[model samples]
Target: MDYNFLKSLHIIFVVSWFAGLFYLPRLLVYHVEAQEKDAQAREILSKQFEKMEKLLFNAIMIPAMFLTWITGLSMIYLTWWDSFGSHTWLHLKLCFVVGITIYHFVCRHLIRKFRASEFILTGGQLRLFNEIATILLVAVVFLVIAKNTFDMLMGMGGFIIFAIVIMAAVTIVKKIRSNA
Candidate 1:
């Protein structure tokens, strides 16, 4: 098959993958905020998000990531051949991609609990998480673009800070929910 065709498909898929990554958390924010637990609205929201995630990965993200890596490596093999292993940008991108993938899985587990009515963050906490998610996505974009700088460190640090904030927000929200 044509390399250019694969690369084009790869780019399209990647764009779709990132689009889903961008939107899913926002949906979660809405899902978490709604007070209609075990109601029709909540169930609909859960199903919609589940469908989105499934399509995003199976129909778009996974294939795109695979194509991108394969075509990218093929291009590298055909072009650089020898020095491809030492490419720092590629390495950095790999780290970021893998980290995001791990986060995706963790989010899946959490969202399942959410769907099961076992865990639900309050509206305010959902807002906080939404903000943090936006920041994290921005940080990821910056890391991908900058590729080499104190920015990568900043991104990692941002992730840590956001993680802490999420934890604290969870604690507070749970307290609020329990009290109310």
Candidate 2:
């Protein structure tokens, strides 16, 4: 298989997977917020959100994640098998990918909890939680684009700053929504 072809497939699936990762949390937030509705509305919204979450996670996210892994590993095996150790950026990117993989399963767990009517986190917290994928996406994209020239210390500092900004923005949005 051509490396470029595999790279393209990897990119496609990565985008698909990230779309799920990004949207699933928003669904969870909606699910949490739906609890504040009237009893009948809450029941209807909860069931609908659960079904949507299940369909999104199972039909889209899980498959995309698997294909992303397969295509990614295939590319690595084809191009970097011999010189893999020297690619610090690849290592960092893989670390972030692992983080994303963990995040994906954690989402599944959250769905299950929601199915059981276990709303553990507030809507605001879940809104903040959704930014985890954003952070990982930024880190992974930076590592890939920067590749061999990537600086670890600078990246970490940038991630911390970005995270603080995201948290502050979420807080402000929560405040604005409450006031509205």
Candidate 3:
């Protein structure tokens, strides 16, 4: 298979995986918050959200994640096998990929907990948790785009700042919504 074709497929799967990562947390936020409603409404919304979460995770997220890994690893093996250790950017990107993979499984755990009527995190906390994917996305994209030329110190600083901004925004939004 062509390297470009593998890269393209990897890109597509990354996008799909990120879409699930982005939406699944929001669904969890809704699912957690739904518990605050009246009993009947809570029951209805919980069941619906659970169904949605299951469908999204099983049908979309898992497949996309696996494909992303397969294609990404394929590209790496095909292109970078000989000099993989020399690619600092790729190393960092793989770290971020691992982070996102952990995030993905944490989400799976959350889904199981929700299914078992265990609401461990509040809506606000889940809202903050949702930002993990966004942060990882930024880090991975930046590392890939700035490969080799990327300054480690500046990149880490920028990543920290970006994360702070995102968390602050989420906190502010939560406060604003609570006030309203």
Which ranges in model 2 have alpha carbons more than 4 Å from their true place?
none
Residue-level lDDT of model 3, residues 78-141, one tens digit each, is 9999999999889889999999999999999999999999999999999999999999999999
Tens-digit lDDT string for candidate 1 (124-164): 55555545445545555665567555455666787678777
Residue 125 in model 3: lDDT: 95
User: What TM-score number comes out for model 1?
Assistant: 0.58
Structural RMSD, model 3:
0.7
- Among these predicted structures, which one has the highest lDDT? 3
Worst 10 residues of 3 by lDDT: 86-95
lDDT of 1 at 76: 60
Steric collisions counted per model? 0, 0, 0
Of 2 and 3, the candidate ranking higher by lDDT: 3
lDDT tens digits, residues 78-111, model 2? Answer: 9999999998888888999999999999999999
lDDT of 3 at 73: 96
TM-scores for candidates 1 onward, in order = 0.58, 0.97, 0.98
Top TM-score model:
3
